[model samples]
Target: MLADRIPIADALHGKALELVHEHRAASVPLLERHLSIGPDMAEALLLRIARETTVVRRVQSGLYVYTHGPIGEELAALHGFAQEVLVALASNSVDVDQLRDAAGRYGFSIPHQAAGNATVAVPLCLAQVVNV
Candidate 1:
C-alpha cells in the first residue's frame, strides 16, 4: 500500500485515511489486515472516515476511497494533499485535471464523477512541497 510508506496520523481516523489513500480503493478486510483492527473497529472507523471519502456506490461493496472532506479537518496540508491527489489519480493513472477539479472535496458523487472540492488551504501549498 502506498500509504504504508507515507506518514500516518497517530489517530485511528488518520491511520484509516492513509490506508484507503494508499490502496486508492479498499475493502473492510484490507483495512483489518493492514491496521490489525477487528471488523467492528473497521466499521466504526469507516463510519466516521466515509464522510471524507468517496465510496463506489455499486462497485465494490465495502470499497472506501478517500477525498479531502470536512472530516479531514484534522489532517495536515501535506498529507491531505497527497490523499486528495491519490484519490483523484486512483481511477485514472495520471490526471492533472483531477487535482485542479473541485478545487478537491465537496461531497459524494457517482464514484469517479466527483472532482470537486479542494483541500481547503491551511498552510502547506501542493506546489511548494513538490519539486519539478
Candidate 2:
C-alpha cells in the first residue's frame, strides 16, 4: 500500500494558518519562533498567508491583525465597548448604575458579595481573559 504525504511547504502553510488563528495575530517573528524556521521562510509564510487568506490583514509594517471568526469578533466587540466606557467615564456622562447596566449587557456584572473585597476576584477574571 502507498500513502500520500503533503509537501513540506504545504505543511508549513497549514501550520502557519493555525498559529495565526490560535494567537489571533501574526508576525514574522511569531512564525519563526513557533515554527523554528529561518527568517526568510517565516517571512515567506507570512506573505503567503496574508495574500491567500481573508482572516488576516496587515495593520502596519510586520503586523497582522485577525479580523474575522469568533475570537476576532469577540475581541473587536470588547474593544468597542471599552472605548465607549472610557469616553463616558471621562466625560462623566453615565452614572454608576448606568455603567453597571452597560457592563451587564457585555456579560460582566459587579458581584454584590465582592463589594469591598474586589482583590479576590481580580485574579480569577484575569485567568478567564488569558484562557480565552
Candidate 3:
C-alpha cells in the first residue's frame, strides 16, 4: 500500500520540507547539503514543492523567499510528509542553526552560506506550478 500510495510530488515535497526544517529557511546550499543533491536538483525540488502546493511568493532577482505564515503552512500541507516537519519548525520559530540541526538528523549536510542566505533559488520544474 505504501508503494501504491506514494506520489512523486509527495516524496519530493517531503524531501524539500526536510531540507527547509534543517535550514530553517530554503536556500540552495542547505537543500543541496541536506539532500546530497546539486544546486540544480535542489532548486528543482523547491520549485516542485512550491508549485504543487500552489504557494507562490515573490522572487527577488532569481531567488524565492517565503515567511512563516499561512502560505507556508498551506504549502507544507500540500506535501503531507512535509506538513508535520514544517509545523514543528515554525511553531518554535527557531533560527537557521536549529533548522540545520533538525536537517542533520535526517542526514542533511547544509553549507554555511546557504544557512546564511535568505533567498532560495527555484528550478524550472516550478514552471508547471506557475502555469497552473
Candidate 4:
C-alpha cells in the first residue's frame, strides 16, 4: 500500500477524489468550478492529491490523470480503512494500542511518539486527515 505521504484535509478529500475518479483527471480550474473554492485551495487540493495518493499522477504543471484500475481501487479502499481507524481513535470507542496495531496491519503508521496516550495520539493520528 502507498503511504499517506501528505495530509489531505478531510473536508476536501471526498470531493477531490470524486472529481478525479469521475473525470479521470483534474486541474485547478476544474476543482474551483466544481467545489466552489478559490484558486489557492484548488491548487492545494491538486498538490495534495498528486503527492499523497497513487490514484492520480501529475501529468503537467496543473493537471493530474487518475490511474484508474485495480491498483487505484485498492489504494482507495486502504484509504477508507485508514479513515475508519481514525474514527475509532477519535470516538474513544476502542483501546489505542489495539487501534495502533490494526492500523499498522494496513500500512498506516502511527507516529512513535503517539504511543500510550489516547488524548494526544488521537489528534496526532487525525492530523493526517484533517488540520489540527
Candidate 1 contains a number of clashing pairs equal to: 7
Tens digits of lDDT, candidate 1, 61-120: 545544445434434334555776556556555454455443345331213435652333
User: Using Cα atoms with residue i matched to residue i, what is each candidate's TM-score against the true structure?
Assistant: 0.36, 0.44, 0.40, 0.43
Cα error of candidate 1 at position 37, Å: 0.9
Instruction: List the global CA lDDT of all models.
Output: 0.52, 0.62, 0.51, 0.65
Candidate 2 residue 55 C-alpha distance from true site, Å: 1.6
User: What's the lDDT for candidate 4?
Assistant: 0.65
Q: Could you tally the backbone clashes for each prediction?
A: 7, 0, 5, 0
lDDT, candidate 4, 1-132, per-residue tens? 122344457878778889878887777778889999877777778777777777786664646667678767666656665677668768867555665665566555556544544322333545454322
lDDT ranking, high to low: 4, 2, 1, 3
Against the true structure, candidate 3 has what lDDT? 0.51
TM-score of model 1 (CA atoms): 0.36
In model 3, what is the error at residue 32, expressed in angstroms? Answer: 0.5
Q: Model 2, 16: alpha-carbon shift in Å?
A: 0.6
Q: Residues 30-89, candidate 2, lDDT per residue (tens digit)?
A: 988999987777667766776676677666565777766776556555655566566775
Clash pairs detected, candidate 3: 22-99, 22-100, 22-103, 33-109, 34-108
Query: For model 2, where is the 10-residue window of minimal lDDT?
Result: 118-127
2 against 3, candidate with superior TM-score: 2
